[model samples]
Target: MAETAALAVTPAGVATRRTVTGMLHSWDLSTGVDGPGTRFVAFLAGCPLRCLYCHNPDTRYLRDGGRTPAEEIVREAAKYTGFIHASGGGATVSGGEPLLQPLFTAELLHRFKHELGLHTALDTSGFLGGRATDALLADTDLVLLDIKSWDRALYRHLTGRELAPTLAFARRLADLGKEVWVRFVLVPHLTDAAENIEGVAAFTASLGNVARVDVLPFHKLGAAKWRALGLDFTLADTPAPTADQTAAARAVFAAHGLQTV
Candidate 1:
């Protein structure tokens, strides 16, 4: 669990400060991918799933990250607010599953939305979606939801977790009328099956709030990280989907009447 500093109290026994902290992997600025324009992306550490193609395998454990206060992260983002806003970008609280540290994630989202005055996005696998509170979702403007596979068995094999939770979460998000961008990574010989892609496309299209679908091609960018962590990169030889294959997958979503990217 991420550590939280004890609340400071005044002489009258009134609480003055309460610092919500969590394990933070790192943060960076990115455009076109993370969200909107240019985003100040906070990559919180600790995830519930063990995805086979995770590029940031080093962020799998909380111990691998530094304990960071929510205020500190907000302050850092505040610095780039001008640039971020100018670029039509915002702040994204991503993970090792930000929902793992719900309180900290909430604080950051609230501050980013109210204090920093920026669009907020939550990039999550949605496996821990139940952990997210309504208030947390209220502060979020967009959700970058990853629905890795449509096949339950394939999803389990790929992420070491069931796909039901993610599906349920997607439904919940849809019911709430929240804006969402569905992300699907197309892995050759794994998630590239037509049926698998169709399953994802059909579900995403059925969600009224889904704005677009991102058919990301699987890549081995994190293979070296896995090697450095002394863990086997299982998909080391699994080739990335070809352009034609990726386009075909996007066509599936487009056929379902979803805006595909």
Candidate 2:
């Protein structure tokens, strides 16, 4: 595949030439990953979390995606500005992990807001932290935070990482009064337990800024990506979550008055 054109902006109002690497393209009128409405999604390269059910394994590499300058992405996505605004949509910077590229995402969001007056959203796993995270959130308009598993043990098991930091980060985001859309993958026999769901619901309710909750049914879409990369797929035998399973989990949040869908 050919690389995307370069678009770079320096701090002093200078635009530099560069090339975009590992850039993937998508132009669909479907609902945002969080909900309904057309969105121009930019799937950033790399991720720190390794959720067992992650479907975008290709996105986990640190630098697999080409170095598409922030300006280039903003420019390309700008084409859909009209439709995005009219439909109450905007650019969503998702990732292997968008938080990993805070500077780039910030630039994109800043440009989209200041230049195009477009809404901006970040779909994050709530993992990355410290100064980088703070900078990214500073410019983000809305956040789609994925609370993988409520139980600390299960969270570590699912993503091979600690959960406390992510939970704390969520609280911090809430304290900042940022609009948050909490999402959880309904993984049957793993993450959809009644207790876990309730625990997540309670935690989110405590935050008070979680505008909505989403129950994304577990799928194997990332299995292929794993295979292509010559890695063993762990969830090969795992089946996708059924509608009833997802509905039941969604009900847990709704029952807690969490406005889940």
Candidate 3:
């Protein structure tokens, strides 16, 4: 466990004092998938959703993670500063759902941007978007928001949560002019309905701040994790979207004049 009593700056550039700590699942380096260029992604613990195709079920609970100080994470990310900068990469605070711990998430974003001089991003389900303070959003260069489903009922069925919050958050981000990358999982016989995809695409396009849309194909990569966790992997038999299916989904977003990847 790590802890830090460091002064952090607000979006206004005013200094504030606080003791910041967070439950960390782990950290890794990745490119393209996370954000522009390469990135050092911190996978925080805990989440508010149980998406059927979640790849990291181990991060579902806060207690399952290690307590680490904000400074500790900053230090670790600093080690990659040169590489990240050279590659035009940055740092991303991701999670089971980052907004589940807004304060800790805010602190990390602040340090990643101000302290490490890295572009900062927040990857969240947007279910807890209300928790993210404006100051926090101010520090985030981009938001990787997951909009699980456009149909309300399917959303509830898929994530065991309502979709209203995510939509509301999207609207708010648009109002704030926040840069966003909307991510949707395309599952065969599940979220593959054209109307469902269109709903998401249309709504995302309506949000002027959205930079792009990611039509991720749903897969059973996390089935083994669910089995290990003694939880049912309902999507085990679900097939990944074929290349044509994926392209069609991307075309939906493209039709809305939004970039897809």
Cα deviation at 194, candidate 1, in Å, is: 0.7
Each prediction's TM-score versus the true structure: 0.97, 0.86, 0.93
Give the clash total for candidate 2. Answer: 5
The TM-score of predicted model 2 comes to 0.86
* Residue lDDT tens for model 1, 176-255: 99999999999999999889998998889888999999899999988999999999998998898889999999999999
Over the stretch 1-261, how does candidate 3's per-residue lDDT look in tens digits?
A: 322356788999999877699899999999999998899999989988988889999999887689888888899999999999999999999987878778889899999999999999999999999998999999999999999888999999999999998999999999999999999999999899999999999899988999999999988878889999999988888888999999999998999999999
Ranking by TM-score: 1, 3, 2
Report each candidate's C-alpha RMSD, comma-separated, in the order given. 1.2, 4.2, 4.1
Report how far residue 184 has shifted in candidate 2, in Å.
0.4
Q: Least accurate stretch of 10 residues (summed lDDT) in model 1?
A: 1-10
lDDT of 1: 0.93
In terms of lDDT, the best-performing candidate is 1
Q: Candidate 1, TM-score vs. the true structure?
A: 0.97
CA lDDT scores, all candidates in order: 0.93, 0.77, 0.90
Residue-wise C-alpha lDDT for candidate 2, range 1-261, written one tens digit per residue: 323445578999898865444343322344657434667778877778877887877777755677666666777777888888788877777777766766666666667677777677878877885434665677678888889889999999999899987888898888899999998988878998889989999999899898899888888877788889898888799888888888888988998788877
